[model samples]
Target: MAAETDRPAPEALISAFEPDRLLKQDQSGRRIAILGTIHGKQGILTAERAAFATESPEVLKAFHAAITQVTNLGDNDIYRWYLASSGGTNNVTAAAAAQQPPDLKLNLIWPCTESHIKKYSEQVVRMVTETPEIYHDHVRPYMSAKREEGRLNWVFNILEGRTEQEDVILRDEGHRGGAGVAGEYHYDDAFLMLPDLNWDRKTMGSLHLLALVQRRDIWSLRDLKKKHVPWLKYLRQRLLEGTVKMYPELEKDQLKLYVHYQPTYYHFHIHVVNVMLEAGATQATGKAFGLENIISQLETISGDEEAGMADVSLTYFLGEASELWTNVYGPLKRGEKPQAG
Candidate 1:
């Protein structure tokens, strides 16, 4: 039997969130507000929220559901990796922050700079398109959905808050589903903020994340290129203005805006994160797209049919445990350490 010390109790893994008491909001301002906490065996999967402090509650809810599936939660060690930060990182003093490489210095995607980013992205695009069975099904179904009927629309109604009413630290024009979420887009502007707060609002590891949702249908950066830059411009403006309104403690220079290429969901959402926090460690790397680099590239792009989305090369992680690595490229498996980028 595993020693008691080897695994923390499941209750310790989650802090402010209770799956049953969780509420949902839909069109017309009505809510599916359940108000009670349930616990027992199923509570184990809440680990990722603690691990990826900035991910929206919708994203975290989906992750807990996916990981706990009998097939997905295969290796126990891997499960612990996802549970790395339940206790929080608040105790790390500022002096320790200097010892680590700032997330800005890291190659956000495919950490290796040579040919990995392009090659990895190409492999993903081809596989997700040509051989989708290996895609783990997260690539999204917009390709097969009926866009005419408004099915599979991301921005129409997606940003559901993960925490309870009193736990929210901030909410803005783009914020949806904590208490008030109307089906129609209510904000005249395109920015949103939700501080992904744990039960302990003061937890050191909490991510005061904000998102800039574009007015257009720009899914992930995979669909972005030179022509789609006006959205980037708007994102920059939102980051500047929203930071002041919500996080007066931070400055424009101390914050960063990032987009995850293999974002948990499909939406052209820009992440506004505090620069001092080591939020990047939660994301495996390669998946985190630097918005600054994207804006710079957008400014230089020449508008031509040929110079389109291809201009934005990218890479997403497909670990050996993933169906893509196991079923599609089974022969390549040699039990190497997961690069995680």
Candidate 2:
């Protein structure tokens, strides 16, 4: 446990997101999963917790004494933040051809000044380009497509035989976001809309809009387990039953739902935006994940079986315009030796 570069930092940035602090570590010594999500920042610890969340426990006990005077989450001036793309409500993209991961010496610093690297770019490493491919968010890089017959054949092309209900925004036959019935454990009751809404602008608080679709074609969040915990307990009962049939005054705490580790396309979707925008802020770290921090990392595991979510270890944020991190964390950030995906 000491080896997270010798365990020192966390004096409590919420105890570096507990669940027994997943495995913390990072900065390349690996061990990741500091999962409580929301790394999207505008810093000063998000303006001193929005300036003590409207003050009053005598200014919330001086905001817990200024959050114990922030004990370094790698204090690069409060962990240096930046991400400003406002092309929301309706957008257009394609300026991101920058590719620069060779120098390798980052500690999770994002300077996406004026954004739109498509939902905050963060595919921190992936593989297969020796040919054979498949992906099509209709247009756009759509995570560089590649899959012809096998492997998530587009989740059976949206859960089998299209009846094409005109861009379905919400339907719940029971669970995979709602068309229900997929073996009863790894639900995907379907609630759609992400032919690309990564820069949502249904602007209520800011990041408004939805992206649910789980019908069981497991791919990312390391293909989560414990029988997928009833697809995150049915997206926390649709984020607490805010009755969404196109926002019928929806505001279950401005909705959140999440999951996306290098996801642009590989099926297994769910974004449900707006909790005041920037969930992954133009992405670029281990991609997003927050279904209430993976239902609290599956209510803190039991008998392994993906409930340990691939044994919960972690590390992410590889971007040299990723060809699997220019082929894997640009060769372990240059100490060489990574390749094999």
Candidate 3:
């Protein structure tokens, strides 16, 4: 309704929300979608309610008072809790449960339009086979252009401590426990570990984390060279060890570390997730490449320091609506050179 700087406080807007209807709810019951409006807003609000972060104070306090039903999703330590009123009500009536709102996961989009809703809706995905030639000739240029457009400002914001600093679990500023010589690693080689937005942070089985390097030169895994093998190995070990230290309930063996071929951002980052987490499209074989495998590949590659991931082919899937598909692969599929945006 207003410029971001002039927008009302989230608490004020939330208090004034009026739900028009329930739009959808995922089968896991962890997410619920709704169409609604703020008390004074002119346009609809597309909002979603998800499970609260497990470590949140509200969840800790409410866990004892409002839990009416605790249904085990499976033996994998996933459980869904149905909350009743905050008064510690013993009456387990369906109507009472229905009247109570969900716990504290609210993501709101105010003044939302039909186009906004359509953009977020599901889309078709197709598998893409990318040869080294195609990557060097077309995709690399597309990636460079996209990066020049400042798409990674948010990532830089976090890395520079301009925002989301509280969410960082660990920050390693280029020193490998003082083991290496000075200048062996560049100053920008610093990396940090933080929770992924998708994680609830409390579920051991659903743990998701990210390790992002600060250097701007390496755009993705492709930029990794044999010379960077030691750095990669250090990153993998630190990510695993740091996570285990931060979350004692988890062990090194319980974690799965990988890197995405076509990362959402053009930054070299590793995805650290729990082994018990469901293997969704994100973890699918075509999309995720194991860190160990990459290490082994680099160790055995023929060339000197310059030999790297770019020397090989990579196959992955792209959403039909993605710019890569629209501007690159789609054109190539028609027997044409990939077009630039």
Worst 10 residues of 1 by lDDT: 73-82
lDDT of 1 by residue, 248-313 (tens): 665788777788755544556666665655543334465676787886776677777335444443
Instruction: Rank all candidate structures by their TM-score, best first, as comma-separated numbers.
Output: 3, 1, 2
C-alpha TM-score for every candidate? 0.43, 0.25, 0.67
Question: Model 2: per-residue lDDT, tens digit, 8-61?
Answer: 465555434323234333222212343343233221211111112533677556
**lDDT measured at residue 265 in model 1 versus the true structure, 0 to 100:** 42
For each of the candidates, give the backbone clash count: 5, 32, 0
Each model's lDDT comes to 0.44, 0.44, 0.75
Candidate 2 residue-wise lDDT at 37: 33
Given candidate 3, what's the lDDT at residue 151? 65
lDDT of 3 by residue, 204-276 (tens): 6778899989988999998989988878878888899899999999999999999998887799999999887
Query: On a 0 to 100 scale, what is the lDDT of residue 207 in model 3?
Result: 86
RMSD of 3: 17.0
lDDT of 1 at 280: 38
Lowest lDDT 10-residue stretch of candidate 2: 131-140
